[model samples]
Target: MRVLRKRMDKPAHLGGVLRDALKASSLDVDLDLYRLWEQWTDLVGPVIAQNARPAAIKGKLLLVNVSSAPWMQQLQYLKSEMMEKLNSALEREAVKDIRFKIGPIE
Candidate 1:
């Protein structure tokens, strides 16, 4: 009983303890989206930068802000392809659809 009590008092490994705590939280979906947000610019860069941002309502969706009507038309034409590329890069079909809107005057 003395030995067991002494062992229980040992300090926990910080890394492992933290991992276990995070796992217990069970917020994987939220975490995944956060990670994707951090990597958005790097992952899609020019393709999406200044064009889109992720928005969560009923489900995951991308809100695209286009510079002009022509650009909007171009993006509208490639909506499905863009969704495929984004979801593929994230390794999960997180984005269910894309919503395009005209950007505010610059």
Candidate 2:
């Protein structure tokens, strides 16, 4: 049993460890995205909830739906400024753009 334990501890068998590290990194990315989505939506909720719904995409952009053309136009004007504020708040460049769409609402 002692010899078997020594063999099992060999550093040459680190392939499994490498795979686990990759998996953990992937999971970390997923969790980060989820948290950013939750935080950003919550941050912008009151401002846009009545006028839009937003989703985070690829950690680089936010897709928003506006119920009216006027709001869409307004949002377009503030896009970059909003992105800067959001990225600053998130402490990372989590969003580089905001895409607006017309919502299916009267």
Winner by TM-score: 2
Task: For candidate 1, write residues 65-104 as lDDT tens digits.
Answer: 6666776787778888877877787687867887777775
TM for every model, in the order presented, reads 0.52, 0.56
Record all residue pairs in model 2 with backbone atoms less than 3 Å apart, i.e. clashing.
Answer: none
lDDT of 2 by residue, 11-48 (tens): 65588787588556656446545665566556565566
CA deviation > 4 Å runs, candidate 1: 1-37, 41-58, 104-106
lDDT of each: 0.66, 0.67
RMSD of each: 7.3, 7.6
Q: After aligning candidate 1 to the native by TM-score, how far in Å is the CA of 95 from where it should be?
A: 1.2
Worst 10 contiguous positions by lDDT, candidate 1? 49-58
